[model samples]
Every structure is written in C-alpha cells, then in structure tokens.
Target: MNMGTRTDSRFMHLADIVKVNLELEQDWTGLAVHKSSPRGDGDCDGQKLLRPLLSGLPPKRLYIHPDDQIDMIKNLTGPGESETEWVLPLHQSENPTTISMLASLFDSLPNPPVPSRRKRIILASVHNDSTVVYYIVHDGLVKPRQN
Candidate 1:
C-alpha cells in the first residue's frame, strides 16, 4: 500500500482506541494524540516508523512504584491523584511491536513527575471486535509490586 493509505489506516486504528477508552467508565481526560517526526541521519531510523501515541489522565492512579508503595504505607497516605500517561494503540493484527520502537516512544516523553519514578506507558491492544486490552509497559526493569 501507499504511504497515504498506511497513514490513514493507522489514524483509524488510533481513533478506534480513543473511542473505546471514552466509552469505558475510566473518565479519561486531557486526551491528546502525538505525532512523531523522522530524525536526522543517525542510528535512530526506527523512530521514523513510530506511530502516534495517546496521552491522558485516568480517573485513578493506574500504577505505583514498589518503592513508592512502601513509602505510602509508612506514611499512611493514600495513592495520589493520577498523572498523565502515554498510551500506545496497536491493532492485534499488526506486526509485533519492536523494542526499539517502544524505546523511541519512551524517549519522546517528558520526565515523570517524580524524578525517581520510571518511565511507563499503557499498551492498548485493539481487537477486531473493538476490545482494547491495556497493559502497563515500563521503559526499563522495575521491582514488581507485592500483593
């Protein structure tokens, strides 16, 4: 397919993801779709294929670092308000996403509210039936939360 057709297909998939999220009860806010531009000559050519990413704030905190969880327990403080998070929408039928692509996406984002916090994004896998399965994806290794 031509570049325009490919671009249009990606946009439609992104729209579907947004629509499914809006229809859910999470009350997503400050929704924004980001476009990526190709970088100058370098080893970052893969970044050029990076798709648009969705970013917004959920109604409640979706994740807390293991260290933060301990701090919260010690301080007897409840989980804080949710922060804006990156969302990558991928159609199930699409080719498997590459680590380099994800790394590029992570690099594009601004630092987290807490400097100690790790970078993460919500990976939304859209299915043909309009089902969107979300998974938390961190940029690097992080201690898993205890039950």
Candidate 2:
C-alpha cells in the first residue's frame, strides 16, 4: 500500500476510536469529527500538517474559568451549562511531535460561537490497546480554578 493509503486508513481508525471514546465511553453528545485539509511532510510550521479534531458537548462542564467560578461561588449559583469543546485525537506514539503541531492548528480553528477570552481543546490520546486518555489544553495560560 502507498503512503497516502496507509495514512488514510490510520486516520479512519483514529476517528473510530475518538467516536467510541466520546459517545459511548464518555457519554458526550453532538460529536463531530472534523476532517483536516491534508497531511504534510513533517512540516509542523505549515497548515498542511493540520490533523482531524472532534468537537462535542460533554455531560457536565469540563472547565470553568477562574473568574467565573469565583462569581458563581459568591452568588451561590450552580455551574450553568456545558459548552462545546474541541477534541484532538492522537495516537500515543505521536505525542512527542504533537505539541509543536498543536499551536499552528489551534490558531487555525474557528472562534467559538460564545465569545471567550481563550481557546481550549481536549487532547484525547489513544493508546495501542484502545485506552484513550484526555487532557485539557489551552491556547495560553489561564488562572487555575479554585478547588
């Protein structure tokens, strides 16, 4: 098989893993797998290296801004609602190079409908045995939430 074919197959497999992990395991709703334009030749600086990203709404709010949390606590209000979040699914083997690539692609993503101070995504790392781990990534430094 050619390189293109192999890449395509691998992408599809990763997409499936993301879908199952989000929908079935995590019980997230409105899951969508966004197709990237194309893969590039190890050029992390270029747009061609963009990878597929998944977006969806989780059952509960996965993140709350520090300021927002303070306000909610002061007013005795509950966590309002969950917002749509971006998810980037990558194989465990790809983690080393993914950090550099993430900056470029994160900037390329469309702004969220609800205006916010920062851009964030859920990084979903898929292991060889199908165990997917998730981490929250932000475009820039954000104040830590109060415990």
Candidate with best lDDT: 2
The reply for model 1, stretches above 4 Å from the true place, is: 37-49
Q: lDDT values of the candidates?
A: 0.74, 0.77
How close to the true structure is residue 28 of candidate 1, measured as C-alpha lDDT?
85
Clashes of each: 0, 0
TM-score of 2: 0.81
Instruction: Give me the runs in candidate 2 sitting further than 4 Å from their true place.
Output: 37-49, 96-99, 114-116
Give the clash count for model 2: 0
Candidate 1 accuracy as TM-score: 0.81
Q: State residue 112's C-alpha deviation in candidate 1, in Å.
A: 1.3
Record all residue pairs in model 2 with backbone atoms less than 3 Å apart, i.e. clashing: none
lDDT of 1 at 38: 29
* Candidate 1: residue 42 lDDT (0-100): 50
lDDT of 2: 0.77
In model 1, the clashing pairs are none
| C-alpha TM-score for every candidate | 0.81, 0.81
